[model samples]
Target: MRKMALVNQKGGCGKTTTAVNLASCLAGKGRKVLLIDLDPQGHAGLGLGVKPDQIEESIYEVLSGKIQIIEAIKTLEKNLDAVFSNVVLSAFEQVMAGVPEREFTLAQGLKEIEDNYDYLIIDCPPSVGLLTFNALIACDEVIIPVDSSSFSLNGLGKLLETIQIIQDKAGHELTFRILATNMDRRTNFSNRVVETLRARFPRNCFETEINTCTRLREAASAGKPIAEYDQHCAAFLDYQQLMKEILREEAKMKAKGFALKSFVEAKEKVKEPMEKEVAFIIEAPEDAGVQIAGDFNNWVPESLDLTHSHGRPVWQKAIRLSPGLYQYKYLVDGRWVSDPSNKKRADNLLGSTNSVINV
Candidate 1:
């Protein structure tokens, strides 16, 4: 099973929007999807047409050991099931404080139901508190909802630091990427924010930027995923493409035999290679430009421009160079950024690491 969490420490960034839509889209594609509402606000359930009072048991009950996780899961349309959230869960931190192994509570509870679905979409709260921590520990991967706004990038450092803490205590098994939501191309500010994000979190970003649309809100108010509500809508189409990109990335990570520890190691490993042709299948944020530059290129930061697949954002390019290892990063919209796809990374003078990939 591929468990993914939609998280953002900043509110109104569309974390729940992505989770609800993506989970519904996967279900529409005939895949079993479980939407876990880790947020105490219970917006996910409301977005899914499920009333909080209607749910007899919730994630709170499961975490508290009052009920089994499987029992808390409420099946919705086709292959979609959701474990609704309730306001009572807001007290989770205080209640779970004295308990040992608090981080693994959600993980242990999810073991029984993980394999039952192809996708488990978790809608995390705005704050990265205990609830978000549990979701991080329980999930296999995370999709960060970065609203195309100026302040979005400012919170990244803190979010990453929290992830580091969780990695130290729980386990370093989770991978994450930025999923730009509420993107408006008509506005110069929006475009600049996207550019900044591309430059900042290169490898950890998705290749699809979800375009803002009124249909998204309409769909949510109607309590349905975009795919089910209106597949022709731009928002729905963007999310569908994003889902495909995520599946492709997951496959690549699995093929590389990456797990939690080794993956992080791979992200930090950067070295000169002895191969003449270095083929890099880089996973970059959608619409971000990638180029090669290093000692061989005198760190010009733009020696080779990477090309994308025709009509697709998944960037791929092959370069011919001397037989030695090189350090490089993707240039997304003129902003230099590290590659999050590869596990091997090497720190540069700028205090950021260039994700290393073996030739």
Candidate 2:
């Protein structure tokens, strides 16, 4: 099954809204979908018309191993099933701390029922914590739901950094896409933020934007996706466009291959001194000097100073490393940061992160 988790460290970025409506809209297209609410807030279930009191067995129970997944999976409607959550999920992190392979708890639970659905949509909580990690471990794609507000914009970098950390620990990288949510198309500020995002990450941002609509808010209150609540609204149309884009992207992913960060596995590596040149590029607008430090050059940051990349707002350096896995990080100006494009990463002993490259 195809899996994606709507995640953002900052709250009120429409994570739950996107999860509920996106799942519903995909199901509307006759694809069987399972909406899993990992947020303790239970907003996804509520939005899907499942009352909190009505949830006897929830995701909390399944993750904690108190019950099997089949017991928690509830049929919400035609072509759609739901695994709800409750406030009790808030304590799951502390409870699972001593458990073995804690990060894979949700993944292991979902494996049993994965074949039963075409898609599994996860609504992650607003914090950077274990629950979010569980959601990340359980899904292949990480869709960052961001509002047009500057607060949400600023938090994007931190969230990206955190994902890098999770990717390294998971021993696999995940592909991420940005979804602009709650955008007020009529407002100049909102339009500017959308423009900034498109310019900043032109290839990673989705063309479809979720607009601010009173009908969408009413649909949430009415416990339904906008498609089910009112198909004529702009919200439904926007989601329809998004669904189309997602399906197209999924088709490409299937044909091209799964994009696991660097797409290199240890066992899959064939020994050949096939030294190929690759340039690591970064957009460091105001930085005076940008350097890269990795195992290919004794981890010396000063050994590889990147030059300007063809007058673009980027710094780049080319290296000929043997076909294998390598981990590195960028020294931009004075601050060190992971290569934002390379999602595979691991934490360094120096309290920073190293971006991974498989070549």
Candidate 3:
């Protein structure tokens, strides 16, 4: 089974919407999908037309070991079964704090029914907390939904860092990618942000962006997936394309012989000297001095400024650093912005984050 988590630390970025629509769309394509609402808000279940009061067996019960996953899932929509959530899930931290291997509980639970579905879509809450950690631990890959806004890019760096931290602590090799959503192409700023994202995160960002459409809002209000509401809507088509892109990417990763392995065990097998390189591609403007600032440089400005060697606006700068986890961002004319060029970021208190390169 293919497990994926729709995650983003910021709220209102379409994380639940993407999870519901993607699962429903994939199921419509004849794939068996299990939608797991890990968020305490229960929005994913509600979107699938499952009423809160109607949920008898939920993710909360499954996590607390009160019931088996088979008993918790409710079939919603054709070829789709969902494990809903409730506000009671907010107490999960306190409830499961003393549980042995708390992070691995969800992973173990999913493993029990791993072969029963083609896809398991996990909808993570807005904050990168214990529930998000459980989703990350349980999933093979993660899809981040980012709005085409400045703060969206700004918050991305920190999200990626948290992923790295999880990978380090859990020792699992999990892949991640960013999908830009709610993109308003008519606006110049939105277009510019897309361009900025494309230039920096070419490999990690999806080619398709979920376009802004009232029909999407309508679908949500109606408690129906986009594909079920209107397959012809731009939003529906976008998700279809996204599902295709995701399948293709997964195929490529499998062909590359990348299996889900514990990074801790895997690291012990690697003895080669790590090569470190820092490359920055500026996206804000020509006058932007894209400097690397993060924990590595004590968040100081001018620590790693891109050289304007070519004279013309060559938008990128490269640097080198020691082997360790690092958080950084491009300082564009005194404004702290994430590498729109990169999709991976981590959460931090300053509302800024950086990417991690093992080397």
Q: Pick the candidate with the highest lDDT.
A: 2
RMSD list, candidates in order: 12.0, 9.1, 8.8
Could you tell me every candidate's TM-score relative to the true structure? 0.72, 0.76, 0.74
lDDT score, residue 193, model 1? 69
Question: What tens digits encode model 2's per-residue C-alpha lDDT throughout 1-359?
Answer: 77889999888888998999899888988889999999999999889788888889999999999999999999988999999999999999989888888998998998789778888899999898999999888777789887885434337766776777777778775667899988887788788778656644544588999887788889988998888899898888988988988877656555556542212231134225578999888877744677886655534564344455567666777898676567677777767789999888754434555787777
The 0-to-1 C-alpha lDDT of every candidate, in the order given, reads 0.75, 0.79, 0.77
Residue runs of model 2 more than 4 Å from their true location after superposition: 253-316, 319-359
* Candidate 1: tens digits of C-alpha lDDT, residues 1-359: 77778878999989988998888777877879888999989989988888878877999999999999988887888998889998999988999888988978898998887668777888999998889888888876778888885444337656766776676676565667888888899998778767655644555668899998999899889977777788788998898998787666556656777642243344344223544766656556565666755433334455344455765556665776644345667766687777666677765424466665443
Across 132-248, the per-residue lDDT of candidate 3 in tens digits comes to 999999986889888885445447767877887787777777667788888998888678777655544544678889998889888888889998799888999999998897667
Query: Which residues of candidate 1, in runs, are more than 4 Å off?
Result: 250-359
Sort by lDDT, best first: what order? 2, 3, 1
